[model samples]
Target: MSLPFKTLIKIERGNHLPMYVQIANELIKLIRGGKLTPGAFLPGTREMADLLAIHRKTIINAYEDLSVQGWIESLPRKGYRVVSDLPVIKPRSFQPKNNYPATSISPEELLHLPAFTRPGMVNDYQPGALIVDDGFPDINLTPYDFFLQQYRQQLNSGILYTLNFQKEEGGLLSLRTATSSFLNQTRGLNITHEQVAITRGAQMAIYLAAALLIKPGDRIIVSEPSYFMANQIFQQLGAVIHRVPVDEEGMDTNALEELLKTGTFKLIYVIPHHHHPTTVTMSTARRIQLLTLIKEYQLWAIEDDYDYDFHYRNSPILPLASADHDGRILYIGSYTKLLGPSFRIGYLVAGVQIIEQAIRYRRLMDIRGDFMMESALAALIDNGELSRHINRSKKIYAARLDKTTELLTSSNIPVSFHKPQGGMALWLRFDPQYPLANLLTNASANNLHLYGTAYFEGYNTNYNSLRFGFASLQEQQMEQAVSILAASLKKK
Candidate 1:
């Protein structure tokens, strides 16, 4: 009998890392470094778990990730085998000239900055999840065939290859120009090309904006309950976080002004149109008030309009940038929500002064930015495929949203939610406060992985809530998911 793989795996608890990823990465390194040769059969998950003295589920998650990523093939009864048939990993460019310095920064300093980490909810990021992930598009509706054809055309143009290696502020010209046009037509903003700085995604756009605008101990205002990720970014930038309460209309501008008078904050970040985590769109009057406050206080407002594309309800809302005549507001938009995240493109609309600073910071982070994907996306948008994709996607999400709402509401499940207009998700609150987070965490055993409102804030709110992204689940699947979730919630 072959020795169990657990005997081969060793973990140091002092490392403070998740056991699943630790084991997974070790296997990946063994394969990539060519130690684990092809066709090797690995130990069964339960056998390895027994040997490691860890949960069997942990081993399963590791195996699942490897399977989804095409690193291994699982055969019934025989166990898992290495997939040496997988192609060699070759990232876009930059032949390794030297090693990256792995230096340690203060934990305090590290805590306040945005992490490039993503939701590890899925085994592999499926195209379908793009609707739920702010970076994903409706994979079912995307015109891949047309895009592949256009990609080849752009590649043959010869301009794309040169553009791919440098972190040109605002991405490539062909791409930037196309994005600017889309912004103009959709949001009604009068912007010249020079003011737009393309970064990786909205997260990077927000990070660059916060890093440039906020200083250590500077005060900045955010919605009382807003995007957890954005809050993480602002806190990482060392901004003194002040949460201005938000209502149906949007951020409490009056409270914002009062906070400004105390001489506490230098910047205010608002989701405005379709405020994150809540799915409430701000009113036009509030937008005007915020712009006025920004100029009067001489403070900058960072607008994260992450999902302006698929307005499922009325006409798409205008971005705060559209109304910024004084440039006091920094507008951040992401193609990640509309385009594929592997594309890694987002833009910042701000005064030329801030744009210049952001460019310097971006270059410091990564010498070369994404070019091939940016170029391809630009061509897709230039040809109007992006708009079509968004429209089709919105319709599909809207239908799914309606169905999800109905299923959860009408089901025997003990949960309630508010219907959002055009976004991909619904915010839900469970009854009598079941341990939603823990339950969701444990529910992985049932093959249902969903998001729970655990990390939404620094402190515990003591409520059982969840944010469900309907974009990925089919209309039919939403009912079943809710049914399973309802049963999961009921379990003591």
Candidate 2:
């Protein structure tokens, strides 16, 4: 039976997509929506062309595409029919609905009360305004031309269909393998491709890991000044968060051990290398102690090493996952920091079983990742471009860090900060006389933007500090920014 192909398939002549490809995609959607059942015969090329008022060659091309994708089969005498072997999917209306009403049910009405509050909208700065972001990479340093070349190559490769429709929720095998090798060589992690699941970013990796391990009423330990977003994720999952102090040695393992003795906790979230907000690397002794505690208490640990590549000082201490023998650590890292926040690519490394579970959980939200970008990144890693970029970035960022530190110290702003061993940002604390809120207001008036410190404040501790991101600013811009900050501080 010939369905109403004219009514079902609305071709957009103005769309940038080719008419043939659009028709093929529409047909596939109809088939999946059950309008065209298995073994249902389709109109011949001429008939379909006449029915749709398109060229016969266009109809033939669409049909051929469908056949190549296994959505349809051509019979000797019967023309084309939907493939009988296609899996039966739940049917939904294929027609586009116009002016659908907003959802009437509020989240609080449908689910548990006290639903997670939405975070404030991001501040939109003027185009030329200088922004002191919270540790973002300098996008100008990205090897985008090389990345684009690899992206084009992947798109034109013989495996284009496979790259477009890969079924692995964990991600492209090539990227995962390359990531496995890169981590092994650079971070000393003993992991295989099977132990890695690519995520949108480290944030998603953290969410997936938390989803896999956390349940309501479960206690999770975090440093006093922890990553707020991670804490919010745990809270949204109904997990109670406990705080341990973070001294110069990192999350005081002694304090955590003492807390562990007091109560049972499901997981510990630590940023051992370049700890967020404070930019303090956990001491080697503390890392060992934390790992030992994890082993002794049979607790899970999430080591978020987001900015491990830009360490300015001596060789970066190997991540906790590098020494994880029993699969206790779920290590997360991101290419966003290496490239920029705009590039959303990260991975979670754990045991094979843990990664398998993470992949399954990830599928509930994201079916698959960007295979083309992942493939391009794989090419970059395979060729030494990524490492070379990191090497160059370290020197550039190290110099900027020095310049910013020198300016801030020499200025009469009355601020104190430790020279970080590694990472992109410097943690600066102004004297109590200069309230961060007031400083932020004054900075804004001077056309300078700075991130707020309220998120880093804890129940009992108020850190009057902000993470001064120096990587994104050059020497002159840093000078201008510091001058603006000094002017802001001088305000009555």
Q: Give the CA lDDT, 0 to 100, for residue 116 in model 2.
A: 38
Position 352, candidate 1: lDDT: 63
Kindly report which residue stretches of model 2 are placed more than 4 angstroms away from their true locations once superposed: 1-124, 452-457, 490-492
Cα RMSD of predicted structure 2: 19.2
Clashing pairs in 1: 112-236, 113-236, 130-136, 164-371, 170-198, 312-422
Deviation in Å, model 2, residue 389 alpha carbon: 0.3
Question: What 10-residue stretch in candidate 1 is worst by lDDT?
Answer: 91-100
Model 1 vs. true fold: TM: 0.71
Q: Please give, for residues 1-492, the per-residue lDDT of candidate 2 as tens digits.
A: 557789999899996447997798788779867899898999989899999998999999989867755678899988999988652212121122111111111111011224333122235766678888888889999989887877676667766776666798998899999999988777777667988899999998988888888878989999888887888788888889999888777889888889999878989999988998688989888888887898899898888995887776676777777774367778899999999988899999877777877888788778999887888888778755676577667768888988988898898788888999878888888777777777777788778888633443448665768888999988999999999999888433
lDDT of 1 by residue, 1-492 (tens): 564455566677765346775687677667666667688877788877887899999999988867755678898878898986643322121111111112211112223443453233546543433222332355666667766876676677876666655556556777777877877667766665666788888888888877777778888888878777788887767778888877778888888888888885678888976677767778777777887887688776788885777666666556767663366677898877775555567898776666666777777665545676777777677644565466556657677777877787788677666677666666666665466655565454455667533332244454455667777767656666766676666444
* Ten contiguous residues minimizing lDDT sum, candidate 2: 101-110
Candidate 2, residue 383: how far the Cα is off, in Å:
0.3
